[model samples]
Target: MGRVAGKKVFITGGAQGLGACFGHMLADEGAKVALTDINGEGAKKTAAAINEKHPGAAIAIAHDVTKKDQWESALGEAAEAMGGISVLINNAGIGTAGSIETESYENWRLTHEIDVDSIFIGTQLAMPYLKDNQPGSIINISSVAGLIADGMMLSYNSAKAAVWMMSKSIALHCARSGYDIRCNSVHPVFTRTPIVDPLIALGGGGEEGEKKLVRQIPLKRLGEPEDVGYCILYLASDESRFVTASEFKIDGGITAQ
Candidate 1:
């Protein structure tokens, strides 16, 4: 049997990038997947592709993770579509690069709302369904920037750091309340995603710049979406029943060095 057989997973920002990768991977493992994104058309397109591959296994909804009402609506829809939500992946976020002094208050607010507040909304909205499931997982996507300092990504770093702490807090609350839900965050270094394409373009995309970045890693390679997807799968599955309140670093020794 697959790791997530018969499981129901709800993922935010699932139309593209790592979120899309997660949806595909989970559906392949026999899970019923519900994906939501701000782009309703993109979500529909992704759902179509997933359904074509997995056949009646996935659904998509439009959701703005920062909005509590949207979270509630999305959760209700997901539960209705997939039986119940056993896993929630808070994957919607944006990146900003600028020194603290140079970063505007508007940028900071946007970063925090998308990266940090989304986690709060997703986790809180999923709580009712998760409570009923008795052994659910809430995985928040943090970043290596969250764990370590990076130049010119002040707002991004701050928001991700908050996500890391929020995961821990929710895990503690669940444990104390005797809820069977588990919460954890995954911190990954530069993974190739649509969000990073612009940065790569600016740096001269190809082996030249790729080699430069890879050299910083002991593994000598950047992470793939599936690399993080598999890590999330393990955490979402029963194999990790005893694990909670942890940070899984998929940074290829970036943080270790």
Candidate 2:
């Protein structure tokens, strides 16, 4: 029942989707969690729900990951609330698809700001606390778009690919510095999350739409949130102590073909 017992985790973008799912899963497995989001009230509500099941195991913090001041303050508050930070999940991001020919520079910049730069800032600010809590884990959520290419997903593809490479660099740095902080990136395919609602809408919004989305996936289905959550659980726990600087693909064998 206690997979991450005594671990303190700080997760960004925990208002909903995978972030909230991860919070619930980790807390259920005995980790105290700090859930942060730009939607402050949403984060609080998620925290309250988790606390309902496991009282005092969850806290909510208002945070804007792109801002240095907010990152510093949020990490400090999370550390104080949870006693220390053993896991950091850089999960806040957006997926706006646009080709370079059609995408505005502003949109590209915003994409990189949230999807790529936030990881750099969050990891840097949280490194000290992670170092303090030896055997820490840093989980960065990338996307299959990062590993592959889509003409329409120009900015998202670029940003998430940056995250993929950055994670490896961070993992190597920690290893070189003798910090037992394992950093890894997770690449998920078209999961049944709100993030895919737009793509679903493009296909006319129904089972048929989902079928179209899964056509390329060898499994012929969308990924469940639990699919990625279980992987994160392993990385967050001591079971994956030797795993670092690697990419975990939650895609349905899309990369294989």
**Best-fitting candidate, measured by TM-score?**
2
Backbone clash count for every predicted candidate, in the order shown:
1, 0
TM-score of each: 0.97, 0.98
Question: What are the candidates' C-alpha RMSDs?
Answer: 1.1, 0.8
Q: Pick the candidate with the highest lDDT.
A: 2
What is the overall TM-score of model 1 with all chains considered together? Answer: 0.97
Q: Write the per-residue lDDT of candidate 2 for residues 72-176, one digit (tens) a residue.
A: 999999999999999999999999989979999999999999999999988998999999998899999999999999999999999999999999999999999
Give stretches of model 1 more than 4 Å off: none
lDDT of 1 by residue, 137-208 (tens): 999999999999877889999999999999999999999999889999999888988887666665678877
